[model samples]
Target chain A: MANIKGAVVVNKERCKGCDLCVAACPCQVLALQPTEVNDKGYHYAFMQNPDACIGCASCGLVCPDGCITVYKVKL
Target chain B: MDINEIIKPENMVYTKPRLMNDNPMHYCPGCSHGVVHKLIAEVIDEMGIEEETIGIAPVGCAVFAYNYLDIDWIEAAHGRAPAIASAVKRLNPKKMVFTYQGDGDLAAIGTAETIHACNRGENIAIIFINNGIYGMTGGQMAPTTLEGMKTSTCPYGRNVALNGYPLRIAELVERVDGTCYVTRQSVHTPASIRKAKKAIRLAFENAMAGKGTSLVEIVSTCNSGWKMSPVKANKWMEENMFAKYPMGDLKNV
Candidate 1:
């Protein structure tokens, strides 16, 4: 596999904190903020290990909210 | 390249589907409808058929599908989406027409319409969302609900003697001669999402090719109605729903 890193931009306002994306991530890079809640009073997903992300976008594809955007950089 | 530099549009790897607007979906958290909607938008966008596509919205939670997807839509009465789609397809045979319906809308109410549309070989597609219970109606036991599944109406759990068996609509439609494709899929996981998208793409292509009816059954989860967290709901569906209604293609031609 090519050496690549990934990042995600989550739209907090739309996120329902379903944790589907968090579970779908192969690298376990995402998790719902335990204390913080969005305007909708839902805990949104955020990258816990951004560097571990592979840019595979498994989280984005599995996201029900369509709020997560993925970016990749080749090493 | 650094992460910041790669964050530019040119370096973007994946984003939301173009057809899916920024308007927030009304579905509950972890609802399968959003994922399925995104898949449909991606399929239509990828196929470049947005202009020549018409969707029929059902009288269920997905009745607002027209608002979500920027496309021509016809609001059909309860259990009449297939009938509406049939007419739309016949009139504009070149356009891709499909229906978005839930278990209550398709299996319970629209059963005859769905059956006849498939049996007649209408050049249309049906996206059936079977979550077992009537989500919009407050967790009532639907025709597709498991025998022992509990719902608002069935507080004591579904009794086979009191209620009929869970309807296997996909398999039932598979037996119809007119149906060209029939598949049962779920979108809880990334891999399954991809497969479901592929199945939908094939179904859309089938409709475009005038191949006969293509029914894509999405065995979904109603987290709110099921009174479980999204994660637990998915797990419950995988364990319980999958047992009653297994995944994979029932018929593909």
Candidate 2:
């Protein structure tokens, strides 16, 4: 497979930490940061492995709060 | 690579809809209302009707819909969104009007308003979120609650003989002559959201074209109300709720 780099930007404060986007990510590229808490007191999702993201936008699509934004680059 | 460079317009794949205000939604984590709200905002923005659109907010968990979507909104009494939307559409025929309602508001108290509006062929759209339970009221059984489904009120599972059967609102509304389009969709997955967005866009277009009433029923999940995690709620909905409500276009004309 071609090495494609992907990036995900999560609006840290807006995320409710529902974790729906974490489950929706096909590449297992997202995870809820256990140590970090947002203003909402929830462990928001973060990019654990950005390079694996395919820019499928699945996370953004399933996010209820529109907190996730995805970007990709083909190397 | 710097995250900033990746987020530049040229590399962007998806961004929040501009029509959606920056206000954080109050819905429970993983509630379907937020996804549906985003889809509606996207449709309104894509249609360029943000300036000429009015939304009727219902008295459910989504009562704050107007707060999230930066559009003209009128807060309606419980179950009165359809009626309010009817009046709004009539007085402002050129403006695109819609009602955002939940199963409790729509199928219970607002049932009459809903059927009457559709039967009258009102030029408006109805976004019906059928999660089968009254989330704001502590997960009480709603008119559309599936049989054997356990809820706060129905702690031992819904009894069909006592609670009656679940109301298939979309199917019922589709039979009404005034309805131009009706579809049941979900927002659990990427493909589904795209399909739902298209359905919403079409419903709006139909309303603007004076094609009578358009009802889009979204079979959604209320994780907080369902007493399940967001992921499990979605799985349960797909396996159980979809069997009863099903998904797809029930009517299009």
- Please give the DockQ score of every candidate, comma-separated: 0.81, 0.82
Root mean square deviation (Cα) for candidate 2: 1.1
What DockQ does predicted model 2 obtain? 0.82
A24-49 in candidate 1: lDDT tens per residue? 88889999999999999999999888
**lDDT by residue for model 2 (B195-251), tens:** 999999999999999999999999999999999999999999999999999999999
| Model 1: per-residue Cα lDDT over B34-107, one tens digit each | 99999999999999999999999999889888888888899999999999999999999999999999999999
Against the hidden true structure, what lDDT does model 2 obtain? 0.92
Model 2 captures what fraction of native contacts?
0.88
Deviation from native of the Cα of residue B10 in model 2, angstroms: 2.6
- Model 2 chain B weakest lDDT span, ten residues long: B1-10
lDDT of 2 at B8: 71
Please report how far candidate 1 places residue A12 from its true position, in Å.
1.2
- Steric clash count of candidate 1: 0
